[model samples]
Target: METGIVIGAGIMGTALARHFLKCGHRIALIDPDEAARAAAAAQIGPSEEFITAPTPEALPAAWGPCHFVIEAVPERLELKRQVLGALSRQFGPDTLIASNTSGLRAADLARDMTHPERFAIAHFFNPADLIPAVELVPAPATSPQTMDLWEALLTRSGKKVARLRADLPGFVANRLQHAMARECFHLLEAGVIDAEGLDTLTRYALGVRLALIGPILQRDLNGIDTHHAIARYLYPDLAANTTPAQVLDDKCAAGMLGRKTAQGFYTWDARQERRAQRVEALLPAVIALARQIETEENDDAEMGEQARGL
Candidate 1:
């Protein structure tokens, strides 16, 4: 069994560790904080295949080098550098040292490595275990051998990997996500769309279709002529500001930081857990239905071609 060592026992780290464990790998989860390790342990539970340690120093001295090492530290640049640097020191050149960073440039994290060509950014989405997508980003110096090894490993672990050639800001999903969010907030503040109205409209009207057909394909389905007309008229008026949204900033200043604070745009105190569970249960089925729709569309087109040939 390939050995997988994950540093930091935060939510993201713990989820990745659990994923590897489920994949039948020997997993070593290390975190400096005992409380964090304890929390992760409680969440993941005891397993003979899993090794838990408060710190790398606290691991059994006999522990050999691992096949894979991933640093799942905080988003702060310096902290990730320090943790990943230490991992590089522990493992040798053949081991692929990776960071579970969502938005950081691969160069920034790879800077601390002795062999920068071995460093990579494997960005897992929130609720890592449930999400199928992972952005596997390679630094400019990263080698083909490293990419090949990770591509095979992550695919075996059940990830729908998107190997990004360029490490652009926000990658793909996040860029489109934030862009749409920018417009959402703009409309909200202008009184064009209320919070609840916007949520319901997006979830039912746009979200359902997006799940069935991705944005570009959907554009083709609707005819690019229509897209051209909309873009010509609306592009200039869309939000282009790089600054933070005033409404969210004001809400944060007022201490309404969502579920943690029990309120933000909506009150989460009473409904948060129940709503989260519902969404979690519904997502898999949504993905399944999306796939079924795609298959049916393909089958119908094939039948049309057969009839025309006959």
Candidate 2:
């Protein structure tokens, strides 16, 4: 078991720390505010104990030698650079440095580091304790051994790890999401659909279908030739429009960009946070359903093979 130091006690950071602690690793959570640290720790409950460091400088002294250090601060390049630089100075060359950046390039981040070989991106989805996917993006200078060890550590912590061969902007999920969202904005701007209607369509149609079979698999099952025919018409139209929709442009002009600004596609209310919790609570059951479907399919395949004596 490796000692872990997680910097930033924000929502995602605290959630990840709780998950790691559940896996029985000693964690030192570093945050500047004592009240924030105490609140986050309390939310994590009494089962797991974490040492708190009031600042990044205090982490190494307080936690001793940490094998892994995770930076989950805000999406700022300079802040991440400073934290990683400090950790490199504090720890040995063997220590793994992971940045929980969503869309940032890992190679760009590791450029100024003393030990770039140990730097990698361990991008976790929001509400880390629930989401199973963790993108393990290794920089060009990152050592193969370091990448392998980090992957193994995350797997042991009960996350499904996906290794990206290249450090592209937005990685995988965000790229797909942004592509869809761009079209969504276009539709809304054109008055093709309202927010509630769009949400309903996504929840009922694409969401349920994607949950059962992924895009590629679904295309295969539905006949790729048919997909090609649809794509042929859709692709040209999708590619033709590079301009952002005017409605979004107007919103930006007015300074409303979702929850951060308190308004965008939808108005923000504090109750939405509670609503999100209720939705997240159903994730485990949803995962279990998917697992059950997979198991049954496997069993059916085995029975058919036994019957055929193959």
Using TM-score as the measure, which candidate wins?
Answer: 1
**lDDT of model 2 at residue 239?**
25
TM-scores for all candidates? 0.91, 0.88
lDDT of 1 by residue, 61-118 (tens): 6666688888898889999887877777767888888888878888887777788788
The backbone clash count of each candidate, in order, is 0, 0
Q: Could you tell me the lDDT of residue 161 within candidate 1?
A: 88
lDDT of candidate model 2 versus the reference? 0.84
**Between which residue pairs do clashes occur in model 1?**
none
Superposed Cα deviation of residue 8, candidate 1 (Å)? 2.0
